[model samples]
Target: MSMFRHLLGVVITLLFVLLTCAVILPILMLALLKVGLPFARWQALCNRWLDWLASLWMDANARHQQLLLPTQLEIEGLDNLSKQEWYMMVANHQSWVDILLLLRIFNGRIPYLKFFLKQSLIWVPLLGLAWWALEFPFMRRHTKEQIARDPSLQGKDIEQTRKACEKFRYNPVTIINFLEGTRFTTAKYVQQKSIYRHLLMPKAGGLAFTLAAMNGQLHRLLDVTIHYPEGIPTYWDYACGRVKTIQVHIRQVPIPAELIGDYTEDAEFRAGFQLWVNQLWQRKDDLIESMKSTGAN
Candidate 1:
């Protein structure tokens, strides 16, 4: 029965994607043309259209999840959120279903989440072009070892990343960062000898760089923590209605004056920011423990 359920989910999801693409592709072509021209207003107009399309796409997915999954989701701290404000959303990564869960949680409460996708993903057929049309930032992050091999390449790539974010200034945007950089696994936990039992060591550079880029424009940081009381659920498990409980806690942290600084050049600021993020991770680990203990989730 579960296998059949998963198969049904797969078919439904594919049909949803195909239907969305069929309508969006033509609009995307026109938006792409407007973006290519030199008119700023036309570009903004196109982005608004893209946002509307993205919102509709997310709403459809959310409705499907609600209808198919018999899961109890407890969400908190999004009461005062406005769709007109710019937000930096940070979360921990656990499963492929995480993104879907997030979309369902924040569907109409905030602007559609825009991710900084890997440059390599730009070749992923329909999805790649969809991301581009939505103006999702495509980034190529350089490792420390790679930068060490070529000293001059140090800050250049980060500058490019900052430049990519420039387009978001025209409208309210919710930029999400998975600080752990990858899904948490037992093997990864053992390899890193991670201090937090629940999470990996966050790569603070990308978040710091994003903060630097948006600077004064960003209103607040949405610190979101997701926990699965029954265990980490796969997409198939979610689709089969096996994911019994999902606990999501969102806290709005005002962006402090100190957090906005040149993280690449200012050593003191970088150290301070990294410490802050590590402390936040520790708190989240404690929250996850508490959530697992209680039946509230």
Candidate 2:
């Protein structure tokens, strides 16, 4: 009976998501075109609507399942944030549910969170249009093998960075990147013998390129650490209300002047940047341990 109820819940939630995407997205796109609005303006409006719709959807689901987020989610250093400032947010990856937690935590406090996604994802059905309307940066990454075959591909990554970040100059934006590149698995942790307790290897190149492109325009870094009380929860667990409480610790780190220069062409700077990222990850690992111990107590 529990399994049957779970299946029914899954079916209903999926149908709700699909129906909302199908019905609302097309109308939003056509409305933008009919009004002869520029893409960015349309995107901003679309994102506002999407956010509202998403919150409504999630709230309904949570209520149905009798699930509640912690009433007093401790957020340190949020008072340091300025409404007029631009920010770069970096966090450790776990599951798709991270997005929900982020939105719930920082929804009105910061400017809308935008992710650096792949260019191919821009055409991904309903979700694609919504993302496009939100003005997410669609990046193109060049693999080492590809760049090795054609050296010219080296600079192409920077060019993609410039194009993707072009709209930020006019808007106060918060760009979020998961430095680990992927979620942590126990098998991966064992294979890599990762330095951090709850994270994978940090990829420095992406962070280097983003900082170089944004330069002084980005003011602050929101370093977030998220932990699940009962092991690492999957997206299914999140939707099914298995995740009862989530602890999010936010720290504000300044963008140092030393890191503002071009990192791709400078070998020394790249190495330095990697070291800086490693230090940050080490601190995050310690924080995760502290949170887990506290929760256990």
Candidate 3:
């Protein structure tokens, strides 16, 4: 049975690659067309096309997963979502599976989910250009030492990332940031001496910087919490159709006026924002514990 599952995992992986390969060319083509056209209307048209292709890609994968796996999703708070509005989603990260789960669950329900990529990723040959064409915001991060050495470097990365964000102002988009920054692990949880029993420390600076950079254009916040009831599963376990259940909770909060400010320039705003984020994280940690205990989820 183990060998059979492993074989199925390989087959499932191959199918995923094939599906991606099928769409990549069209994606690349539209991306090039978008770049060549300087007109705003034309670029908007291209973006719409790209989003359609991505949504279709996601739907296709979902169909196959349902056919191949018995994974059951228990979800709450998705009814109010729409694709027409701009949103910022903050989620707790666990494994690579989180990305797939997010894309699958929210496909077509919101504007295509966008991720902030490392600035250096733009150099990758084809995928990078495609991501750029799709307008995935690339973030340039400078370490404290580097910033200390060059006082001028402070806030430069955010300025660049904000300019990249400016294009989304023309159309609605959902930007997702995993506050934990990295996937959660028991080791990491212990290392950080995490205040929450089930989560690593959630970083407020990224969300603050993103909000400030967007200049409050993001209209709502989608607070998403994902929990694996059977324990953290590997991608292979999910692909092999071994994982049984997933739970998701999304609480949509309005982007309050107070939450938008220069997180870099204003010390007071920074402190308030950090407190707000920490409180939010604490709630999520408590909720995850409830989910674990209640089993009704």
Clash count (model 1, backbone only): 0
Root-mean-square deviation per candidate: 1.8, 3.7, 1.9
Error of 1 at 241 (Å): 2.3
Prediction 2 global C-alpha lDDT: 0.74
211-253 in candidate 1: lDDT tens per residue?
8888678879999999998899888788777788888999998
Per-residue CA lDDT of model 3 for 74-140, tens digit only, reads 9999898888999999999999899989999999899888998888889976558667767888887
Give the Cα RMSD of candidate 1.
Answer: 1.8
Better of 1 and 2 by lDDT: 1
> Which residue window of length 10 is worst by lDDT in model 3?
124-133
Deviating ranges (above 4 Å) for candidate 2 = 1-77
- Can you give the lDDT of residue 27 in candidate 3? 93
C-alpha lDDT score of every prediction, in listed order: 0.84, 0.74, 0.88
Query: Which runs in model 1 stand beyond 4 Å of their true positions?
Result: 295-297
lDDT ranking, high to low = 3, 1, 2
Instruction: In candidate 3, list every pair of residues with a backbone clash.
Output: none
Deviation from native of the Cα of residue 151 in model 2, angstroms: 2.7
TM-score list, all predictions = 0.94, 0.82, 0.94
Candidate 2 vs candidate 3: which has greater lDDT? 3
